[model samples]
Every structure is written in C-alpha cells, then in structure tokens.
Target: MSSDELTGASEKKGFSTRKAFIFAAIGSAVGLGNIWRFPYVAYEGGGGAFVIPYLVALLFAGIPLLFLDYAMGHRYRGSAPLAFRRVSRYGEWFGWWQVLITVVIGIYYPAIIAWAIRYTGFSIDKAWGDDPEKFLFGSFLQAAKTPGPTFDVVPGVLVPMIIVWTITLGVLAMGVQGGIGRTAVIFIPVLVIAFGALVVVALTLPGATTGLNALFTPEWGALGDPSVWVSAFGQIFFSLSVGFGIMITYASYVGRKTDLTGSGSVVAFSNSGFELFAGIGVFAVLGFLATNTGQPVGEVVADGIGLAFVAFPAILNEAPAGVLLGLLFFGSLVVAGLTSLISVVEVGISAIRDKTGVGRVAGTMILGLPMAVVSCVLLGTTGGVFVLDTMDNFINSFGILFVAALSMLALAWVWKRLPGLAEHVNAHSSIKLLGWWRWLVALVVPAVLLVMLVLELRKNLAEPYEGYPAELLGVFGWGIVIAIPFLAMLLSLLPWQRGVDLEDPGSDQLDHADRTDEGSLR
Candidate 1:
C-alpha cells in the first residue's frame, strides 16, 4: 500500500461544502437526457401513464441503487476504481470500465454541445432560415449522404467545438471547489431559471393544451405492456446517472458525517422533477409547432439531437419572438450540456488523479486535451452525426447498463456488503433506509437491467438500428461495445502503484472509531 493510502490522508480533495456537492451531483444528473431523452421516452413508453412505472422504478431501482453508489463512494472515499478496488482486488476493473465509458461519452457528447453553441448564435438572427431541417443537416452540419465512415469536417462545427473544449478544460483545471463546484452553483440555477421561463412562455402559446394533452393523456393500456415498464426503468436508470460511475465518484468527495440518504433523495427527486418540468415545456412547444405547421403533435414530436437542433428551430421560426425564444432554447441546451460534459470528464480526471497521483490541472489537461482534439476532429466531420448516433446506442446499452449490473452484483453478491453498506448509509442520514432497500439493490435492479440488456441486444441483432449501414454498426457500434469491457479487464491486470492499498475500509470504520473515542470521553 502507498503511504498516503496507509495513512488515509491523500483523498482530501473534495467540495468545500455540502451544498456545493449537492449542486454538482444535481448538475451531473440533470443533463441532455433530461432535456432531450426523457420526454420522448416517457411519451413513447406510456405518455401520462408512464409516470406510474417511472415513479415505481425510481423508488425501487433508481434511488435504491443511487444510495448504494453514494454509500460505496462515501464509505470508501475514492473514485470508482479505488472504491471498487477496496471491495475486491478484481473490482478495480469494473471501475475502469465505468471510467472508460465516461471517456467514450466525453469524446462525442461535447460535439453536440458545440452544435448548441452555434445554434445559440443562429437563434439571434434566425439564421436557420425557412427550412430549419435543411439548414441544420445540409448547411450547418453538411451531414453525410449515408451512414458511413466519411470524414468531411465542417469548419462551423469544428470552431465552436474548439471553444467548447477550451471552456470545459478550463473549468475542469480549476480543481473541484473553484471549477466544478463554482460552475455548478452558477449553471444549475441558471438552467432551472431559463428553462422555467421557457416553460411559462410555452404554456402561453396557442396550442399549449393540445401539446400537454398529448403528453399527459395516459394510455392506461400501456401499463400492461412489458415494454413500457422496461422503458420506465431504463429512463430512470439513465436519467439519474447512476450506472455510469458519476454518483460514486461525486459521492467520494463527501465528508464522513455527510447525510448520504437525504442528499441522495434530494439529488434523485430533483433530477426527476426537472425532467417532468422539461417535459411540460417541451410538449407545449411541440404543440405550438404542430398548430403552426398544421400537423398533428405526433407528426412533429422528435427526440435527441433532432428535437433540440432541427424541430425546435423550425418551431421557433414560426414563433412571434422566434429569435429570442430560439436563443433561450438553444442557450439552455448549451448550459445543460456543458454541465453534463464537466461531470462526464471528471470521472476520467478523478481516476487519473487517483491512479497517477497527478494534480488536478495536469490531470485535466492530460485527458481534456486529447478528448477535445479527438471530438473536434471526428465529430466535426460529415459522418460525425452517424458515428455519434451509433456509438451512443451501443454505449448506453452495453457500456453503461452492463457496468451498472456488474456493480450491483459485485456489491450485493460478491462482497456480500449490501447490508453493511445500508448500515453505513442509515448511520449518517436523517432518513433511514429499510432492509427492502437491500433486496431492491441486490436483486431487483440487476435483474431489470439484465433483461433490458438482453432485449436491446436482441433488437439490435435482429436488424440495423435506425436503418444505418451494417459496416458502421459493426465498427462503431458493436465494436466499441465489445472492446470496452475487454480493455477494462486487461487494464485491471496491471499492478497497483507501490504503497497503494486496495482494502482500506472507508467512512464506516472511521465513524466506528469516532463513536468509540466519544464513549471513552464519556
């Protein structure tokens, strides 16, 4: 074990206060998914009826698993790799897997942010012109005619991407308190305020009720569909940012006395609440678009990059205050996406610092520079969207969900530490988690995730996703999905740094020691 590990003193870099930690955690959870993915997924799953399964998933799988992550990180006081390593020598690889997934996400996610940044400017002049779809795909992106590995870089996209990288690296280099914590404080409130304003304005639009009716008119029959239930669980899992090692890494900064359960609940519900809020605004605007275009809301509703860039811009063009509204919409995306990008890169940053003992500035530059360069170079190309779409599907299914399932299994089954971890959480929190929480984390969450994985795999294998080319799916899609875990396991075989301890029991032991010391004092 390393001297620092032996002394338990090296892991001192943390958020300056509890509030900063909460905001940062919230920033991580409320990302592009909240804005882009949730509403569509909710709509497709069961519309208004989906809320029931979603809430059930949150209580049963999302929050319970979130508690597990916080417990692991707080108890171990380390990034995912160190935290998992402390559990078992082999556990470190899972941590690396999570970190690797973050790296992959980090590569392409910022490119979308770049698009948002450009669109924010375009919103000022309605530069997207009459045909927003043609402008977005042809004029701005110069998107490939087909889904292939073509590399025609667009300067418009590349330049903004450079700016995005510069901002991301700068914030990350400032260390946790000055960089992430400070940024979160500013960005999270701004995001909520801006989005809140947008929602209010959207509700005032002519077809707001029509949009909302489409969103909340629950198809009760959807509740009976197993796919709707699966979709709910998937949305909760991805939306909360649990399985990706973000919560674990973020919680590693907490003090021993920090209230894990209360803070976790706040983070969990805050993310969900924001999703619901965003949905209201999103569907409201879509309703307006449908009314303006004389189309049904279903015909106009879109998701992911399409919803943000293409459909929304087209909708804004028809608005009375198109420029101002467009600016606000895309600006919100830029802010939300940037905050998320910060959290995603931090996973890699934290891992580097732990593994190499590098300071924050160097670690940020090390990973940030390469990630920025590659994102700009690759995603700036004509085929960038194709690659981004393919990679996203594969990673979310195999990379993130896979790691989450492994994490729960490792904690609940391999280490047999689920009950002990629950005790750790209850010991420090105002809200006490019951034994059922253990069963939920141990059995329920993993099983649901496993089934989702199988179904997704079956669907993908059955046919090309989105009708993309087979070669693109083979290389960028299945290729990345297969490579990540293999790389993680290989990396795990390497020796730990000299004096680095893998078995340091974290906050639980320290709490016990404190109580014992207090008894003696009494």
Candidate 2:
C-alpha cells in the first residue's frame, strides 16, 4: 500500500506549499552555527581566505548534494528511512542510525538553546549593567570552575532548557502545518530581519575594527594546510545538515512534482548567504571589542560558549541601546536554535512513526525526555559537558557524511532496480538532468565523500592544536567523526540480509500514520 493507503487515506493531504517549505528550509539552515560557529571558523581559517573555500564548497559540493537529496525524497515520497528503503531493499536499517545521530544532536542542542533563551531573558531582567561582560564572564567561569547551587544548578541555564524544550515539543506535537511548518514560516523571517538589523548596528559600533580585522584579514598561507580543506568540507556538511538525514526527511514533505532542483538551490543559497553574512557581522564586532579592550584575539577565541555568554553581553552593555540590542541578538538566537532543534527532533520522530505505530507526540516526548535527563546530568558534571560537545561535533561532522554516502549509494546503485528511477527524479524537476548529471551522481559525489572521509581521518589523527586536549575522549570523539558515514554505508546493506523488502514504501506502512488519534500524551 502507498503511504496514503496506509494512513487509511486520511494522511493523503498534499505536501507543504512552496512558501512553507522555503520557510522551513531557511529555519533549518539558520541556527546557532551561523552566529557562533561560522565566525570562529572564519577567523581560524584566515578570514578572507576562508571565504574562498567556503563559497567553493557551497557551490560545488553543498548545492549539488542538496539537489540530489531533494530529488531522492520527492521520488520516494517518504521519510528518510522509508525513502532509502524504497530505493534499495537492503538499505532499510540504515535510516535509524541516521535518526540516531539527530537524537544525539537534539540532546546537547537544547542545552545551547536554553542558554540563548536564558540570555534573552536576562536582557529583560536588567540584571546586566552597561559593563555586563565583567559579571557575565566572572559568573559563568566561576560557575564552571566552582561547584555549587549558585552556578551549576542555577535556574539561569536549567530553566531555559526546560522552557525551550517545552515550547519545542508543544509545537512539534501539533504536527507539521499546525506545529513545525507554521511556526517556521513566522520565525525564520523574523530571525533574518533581526539578525540583519543587528549586523548593521554592530558595524556602526565604535572600535568594531578589531573584530573585522581578525575576521577579514586573511593570512593566505593558512589556506595551504590540509586541515583547512577538511574544515571547509566539514563546515559544508554540517552547515547544510546534509548527512544527518534531516534534509531528506524535510524534503519528503515537499509536494509531489515540486521542482526539487529549484527548491534545493534556493535553500542552499539562502543557507550559505546566512552563514557568510553572520561570519562578517559577528567577527567584525568581536574584533572591534578585542581591539578596544586590548584583549588578545586568542583569549576571545578560547572562550567558546563564553563568546555569547560573556563577550556579547559585555559588548551590548557598552552600546548606546545595549539592552535592546542584546534582546535582538539573543532573541534571534532563540528562534534559530528552536528551528534547528525542530529538524533534529523530526528525524527521530519520522523513524519512530515508521518503525513502530507510535504517534509523533509520543516519539518526540520519548526522544526528548532522555535528553532532558542527560542535560540535567550534564549540568551536574563538568566532564559531561565536554562529552556532550564531543558527541555533537563528532556526529554532526562525520555522522552526516555517512548518511549522505548511504543516500547516494541507494539512489545511484541500489535504486537502479526500481522502475523508471530517472523519470521519477525528473518528474517535477524544473531543470532536467543532463547525461552528465547521472555520471556525477554515480561517481563524483561518492568520490568526494570518500576523499573527505580520508582527509578528516588524517587531520584528526595529527597532533591536536596547541593547548587542545588529547585524551581518550578526544581521540574517541575524532574516531566517531571518521566512523559515522563509513559505518552508515556499511549498515545500509543490512536490511536486505534480513529479508525485508527495501524496494517498496509498503515495507514501512506505519510511517505515515497520523498520531492525532493517540491522544495528547502521545
């Protein structure tokens, strides 16, 4: 039976409208990374020089892969797990592993979102002075360095995590249109407008050059290092959320016969544009602050979470309308984090709904409850925080790679047995695939992913940057980073051995079941 039939025909409503899908894509792409990770990577990779590789990666690798994903999802008309299984009978089990990565991301991601929410709330409390950085830095570090109810168990972090998760779960429980899809359309644009305004204001701030110089003045020599390439590839993968199976799940919602190539292109372009602008805005502001305060660039860089927690609060406290600016910056962050978290949760939600007969609400709560527990534990232990960070980075960076590989293999090799595969991919595509595009998918994409996997391994195995930890956790983290996609590919071949019908969506008929009948507790 088709997914429509499996849901007893009630779930056969048309897919998300174009505008809604676009909004969701933007929401997924513009997250904490745009504000936090992009600036740091840009500065570390030699400013302007980093821009070249970033743009190159986006154009050649990111965009094409996005189009590829859209095509695959639209063709199968199912979630990632079912979609891949539809492509090849053997690849059915690989979907859960992809979902697993998203679950790991969801665990730590909310904690960060909670931090943003807490910061935004602090803006309203007026607890911060014109020179809040002093208090912000001291408080956070003191809390990290010291153990007591004052910092570790403080409501500042814990409350926000709970609240953010509550709101996120509530929205998700509402389903796509009432929940995920609708909320995205509203917040994604607001996020962009707020971020754009903050950038404009940040540029005008006094002594902003320190941040700009550190971000834009590229040391060309740095580009030659192999690590730079690896970083670029890693950024491309993570920024697009390519390998995580998230995109595939999202694209599955697109209406049948939608222009996969055009929609994918728009999403990729929008995402890359957000990252680029954010890099310029954030680093420039930080550069200015560093120069004016006479603080070393290295110091600012070392304080990863502290950049948002300490530095930005300090910078805002000094501005003319500092509190308002803080509100905008952190408010946008809250929205961004929420949108990203939605995507992360959806990956697992899709899996549970498919593999079992669980409703979306039950799946989301089942998935989220454990994360809440983990976050609470992380709050209690310093080492737990590092472990969470490592898991997120390793899974996001390498996990997605494996997902992407499995996806490509399914479409290119496994799905070749399907009837009219090319015709299905091109059904609603605006630009017809040329003969060359087929070869590119069959050869080029897989080759690029393989090369990236090797480079990532070499770089991780090489000496850690000065002062960086080289312990067992760190090494294990690196290993996971290298193993995620490779293992994904290996796992993609499993379902076939179990005698599952991987070539048809009917194999997972329950995936399309509506949870509304399960009651709210679901």
Candidate 3:
C-alpha cells in the first residue's frame, strides 16, 4: 500500500465530507431502480414476503460486503486497481473487470435516464388526462410504449440525452467539492424530503391499507423459494452500490477518520430505506387507485408504464397536487440516476486519467461522446435497446457475481482469513462484529454467490432468451460482460513487483492533515 493510503486518509483537495458522503452515496443508490425497478421486482418476488428476503440479505450479505469495499478503498486509498492491489497484486487484475463494466454501463445507462427525463418533461405541458397511455402513442415514447405510424425518429430524444450528459460531465469536470460534493450536499437531502413527502401523500390515498398490507405482510411460502433469496441478495447488492466499483472509488476519496464501517452502515441502510419507502409509495398509490377502479392488484402491479407515465399523469389530471408530487418523485429519480451514472463514468475516466495524464474535461468527453452516440442509437431501433437490456442481465447475473465471489475469496481466504480480516474491517468501527460475522463472510456469502452464479448460468443455458434481433448486437452485449474480467486478467499480467505505486501517493497525508469532526453520511 502507498504511504498515504496506509495512513488512512484521502487527498484533501477533492476529498468528501461525511455529509457530502451521505448525499453522494444516497444519490448513487437511490435511482429509477428504486422508484421504477424495485416496486415491480417486489410484486413479482412475493409481495410482502419479499421484504423478508431483502432484509435477511441485507443482514448477511449487503452490510458486511459494503464494509469490505470501503475497507479495501480506504485501505488502499487509490482508484479501484490500487485498492485491489492492497489485498494482493493478482486482485488488482480483478479490479479492471469492474472498471470495464462501469465503462459499458456508463455508455448505455444515459438512454434510460434520457427516457425518464423525456417522460418527466412530457408531464409538464400537454397534460394527457387520466389515461395518458391513450395519448402516449400519439405523443411520448412514440416508438416504444405505443407504436404506430406516429413513430417518426427525431432529435428530441438524442438532444435531451446530450443535454443531460453535458450537464453531468460539466459537474464532474468541476472536481469533487465544486462539482460532486456540492451537488450531493444540495440534491440528496432534497430528494429524501421530496420522496418522503410523496410517501406521506401516497399513504393518504384510498386503497393505502391494502397496499401497505401487501407491502409489509410476510408470505412465509416465499421463504422456501431459492429464487426469492436470490432476488433479495441481488437487490441488496445492487441497491447498496456494491460490485460496480463506485463505492470503492468513492471511498478512496473519503477522509481516514471517517469510520468506514459506521459510514457503510449509514449508506447501506439509507439505500434500503429509500427502496422500501418507494415501494410503499408506488404500491400504495396504485393499490388505492386500483381499488377505486376495481382493477386487480396483479393488473395494477403490471401497470409499469401506467404508474409512472399513465396513471401518474391521470392522478395529476384529477388533482394538480399529484402533479407537484409527481414532479418531486421523478425529480428525485433523475437526481439518483445522475449520481449513479456519474460514478459509472468516473471509473473509466479515472483509468484514462491515470494512464494518459489527460485533463478531466478531455477524459470525460473522450469517454462520454461515443457512449452518447451509442445511447442515441439504442433509443432509435426496436432492437436497439436490446443491447442495453442484455448488457444489464449479463452484468447483473455474471459480472457482479464474479466480482462479489472474487472479493469474498480475496478478503476471506487469500488475505489471511477472517479473524485478522475482521480486525482490519472493525479497526475504526463503532459497531464491531464479534466472531460469527467473520465466519459468515468466509463461508456464507461466498456460498450464496456461488449458488446464485450456478443458477444464473443454468437459466441462461436452459432458457436462452433472444431479445430483439441483430446477432451482432447480442454478441456485443455478451462480449462486454465476458470481456470485463478477461481484459482485467490480461492487464494483471503486467509486472507489479515494486509493490504498488498509487496515482496519488500524497493523497492520504493530504486527507489526514485536513481532518475535521463531522456527522455520518446518513
């Protein structure tokens, strides 16, 4: 490890504060996935029973693994590769795959963000009444949500996507304090307050009781299904911001005295809190509305486009108050997506910055421009979005599992086992694990990951899905997933006999020398 990192500090100039950390992590964790993805997954997973697996996964898998990432980052105090090197030289090779995944995700995710932005903006003027879906085909998502002769490709989608990307790049290029930290400080709390308000309103709706009961009640049968456990584990891992190298890279920028374990706890819980809260908000509003309309909960739950794009606009048409709430909710989603997207871009940008010594502005554009073009194309074709969808599945199923497994192995076995590993983790922890937690990490987490990997691989082999067409695109999609680790291994072949030299050796001292007491990120 470099002298700066071993000393447990970050470079002061672009370092993050506890509050900044909280907002940034929240910003990273709470995304359309929270508002858009989780509700659907929860309903599909087992309704109220889903919470059981989710919480269990959080206890056994998410929190400990998060601390592992933070510890690795703080322990190494550099980019992802440098952090992995602290564990072992071979491990640094594993880090590159993570970097690659982040790069690909950064390239594709803007399309989703662009879509969300378009939907949000669409709600602003041309009010589509209670059944917005009726008008949507003739209006918004003209190609996908409702397709017909009205589908004429235009610069509308691409223009807004570019604007969003440009704005995000500008903030990132401004450096952490002026850019990332500042935006988080302002936006994260606003998101919490706004979403919290939405939840309160959602609960007051007509069928809220059914929604709340559905969300909170436990169905014991779900506990028996292996898929439930797998879903829960996936949610925790994805929501807690692990496996993306985002947390690792972000933690590298935090100060030494920050209490990584404690901070990690706050981040993990804060992430889960938003998800649980958002689920309640979505299901409650939909449930109440469904009851009034006498629609089945299953149909209501399947109202994917309806809830966000259709029913939400309908709610606003009936009550302008809902329009305001809709704005806040979608606004929060936009912020969350941006935060995660920024982290994704930064991973690749950091790699380029380290190797080429390029300016952040130049690096960002170099990484972003091509990705923006790709996102535009994805938005253009019926099959275009397939690459992104396949990429998401490939990474979530294989890439994340591979990294999580490797990370556990490195920490639990290769790094001299858990007793000492636990000490390193609990070094500055206010909530230290006893002994059982160590055994769990060494045994349980890895086993769970292996089972998940096996199931995913089997599912792919047995139920190979062909989304859209264009075999070349399918190949590109799967290729990126496999390429991540494959390239990482190739990069690891380089000799690093001189220990590891960080891109910022002076970072730790700079971080330590500027220490100040601050509250946790939550």
Best of the candidates, lDDT:
1
Q: Rank the candidates by TM-score, best first.
A: 1, 3, 2
Query: In order, what lDDT does every prediction score?
Result: 0.84, 0.66, 0.68
Model 2 over residues 1-522: C-alpha lDDT tens digits? 454543433222323477777777778877887787777877788778998888877766777666666655555555576666775555655675677677667777887777677678787655656655555544432244422122245555566677877888898777766677789989988888898888888888776766777778878998897667667766776778776677777776655546777777788888888888887677656755666678866566623566777678776655665777788888888899999998888777765555454666787787677766766556433334455556665665466666667567666776663225445556667766665566666766667777777665566457552224666335546665555556555655443223223344332332443222232111
Worst 10 residues of 3 by lDDT: 513-522
TM, every model: 0.94, 0.81, 0.85
For 1-522, candidate 1 gives per-residue lDDT tens digits of 444342233223467678989999999999888998899988887789999999999999999989988988887767788788888887898999999999999999988999999998998888889888889889998989988756677899889889888998999888777788899999999999999989888888888899999999999999999999998999899888898788888887656778989999999999999999999999999999988878998999899988998889888888776776777788888998999899999998887767766677888888899888888777989989888989889999878888899789888888898877788788879888788988898899999999999999999889889999889998888998889889988877776555455675655354321110000100
Answer with 1 or 2, whichever has the higher lDDT. Answer: 1
Clashing pairs in 1: 1-499, 1-500, 2-499, 2-500
Total clashes for model 2? 13
TM-score of 1: 0.94
Superposition-based RMSD of candidate 1 using all C-alpha atoms, in angstroms:
4.4
